[model samples]
Target: MWLGSEFCARHILRHCDTLAGLPAFWTREQHGEEASTWLLFTHKYDYLKHLADRYRSRAEPMTRTFSITETAITTSPPRERVLLLLAVALMESFGIQVNLCLDPAYRQLEGFVLDRQRCAIIANWVDIDAVWHVDVNTNKPDLQRYADALDHAQARSAIAAKTPTGRLTALAGLLDLDWQWLTHRCGELAAYGSAGIADPHSRLLSTAGVDRACGYVATVATHNG
Candidate 1:
């Protein structure tokens, strides 16, 4: 699903307590360290991919794709910038010094938490264009495969030719819940129909649960602090 950076961050935080809590994996480091930043990011990416797959599996079958107007991307700042900002906020909240790396060749933005020696504790990579390709059934981006993919001219050309109105699959659309209330209530509404309630708004609330906007607010509070 093509979700904004803020939404992505909150959704991840909602599932996992914090970035630090993400599962660790072994990397091909000379020291054979398990906590390599790249490995940590790979685990994180896998977790997100799993969640997306789960959401996709639950969606109603449909072949149609959803798209927003081209103006949306032109008018708003790039989604990567927003993600970088949120990542910085999250790391800083934990009193970690972070460095942001932008790789134009691959259209990737990475955040690295730096140690005293300026080595990375962990790093996270977000493909800015993944939001546009969520519904395309393409291979999901991963740290290990990223470097090799960058050298493919055809891939770069395809990304460059992407339209302003990005397409998403029906399942991806369902996964792109925007508001906190809607996200929290989506599962409920899907499980139980609107029960023939009178008022439209009331029916929505009745079928869904009470608004719990606190998730976003709490995340923001942590970022601000």
Candidate 2:
């Protein structure tokens, strides 16, 4: 629904040793504010269940919604995959809704997203470091293709087509691309997602150059912009 502060599942598992140690963004002093933490999961499946029960109660929204990006289910080890399935079940039991992010990738997590409230469908392309990167940038036409393919698959699961096995109701993932690209891309893709598409820690505003977090962009763009 609304974009507040978002933290990826793996990052939380990596940085916070205890639930109480969660960033103040999600665990602030004020209790009356309307806020929520978007947990964009990519992996580290084992710890997700350990968190599902603890987070909902502490966050602003008691029954919070969590999000997960396209994960490598088909390629991951069997043990991790099983853990992920179990984690999804646990979240469901806790009354927290989970949404699938990214432009329909045919990950076959239909059981996880079917009829669930849609969350953020972010398409950000970020470079955390020289060796590590995240790319989800996409266009409206691309998303339509994904939706059409998914429809075909459902129609032919009888000779239809398929990609990720579900229809994509997109929102936004702004500040993902460089200024030159985003200025144009954001307008074209806004109808698909949100208008601003910003998350303070992860996808904050920038012009497009280089820094420690985002690798490098066109010369006209800079880190502070």
Candidate 2 structure lDDT = 0.27
Cα lDDT, model 1, residue 14: 49
lDDT of each: 0.26, 0.27
- Please give, for residues 1-225, the per-residue lDDT of candidate 1 as tens digits: 113322333443343333232222111111112112211233333433343343344332111001112232234343322222222222222222222112333333232211111122222223344432111111323433432332242232221212111111111122232433432343353344334432235211221111111222233332221
Q: Write the per-residue lDDT of candidate 2 for residues 69-172, one digit (tens) a residue.
A: 33433344433432333232233333333233333344322211111122112211121222222222234554454444334433433111121111110111
Q: Which stretches of candidate 2 lie over 4 Å from their true place?
A: 1-78, 94-120, 123-139, 149-225
> Once superposed on the true structure, which residue ranges of model 1 sit more than 4 Å away at CA?
1-3, 14-90, 109-143, 146-225
| Root-mean-square deviation of Cα positions for candidate 2 versus the true structure, in angstroms | 20.2
**Compared to the true structure, candidate 1 yields what TM-score?**
0.21
| TM-score (all chains, Cα) for each model | 0.21, 0.23
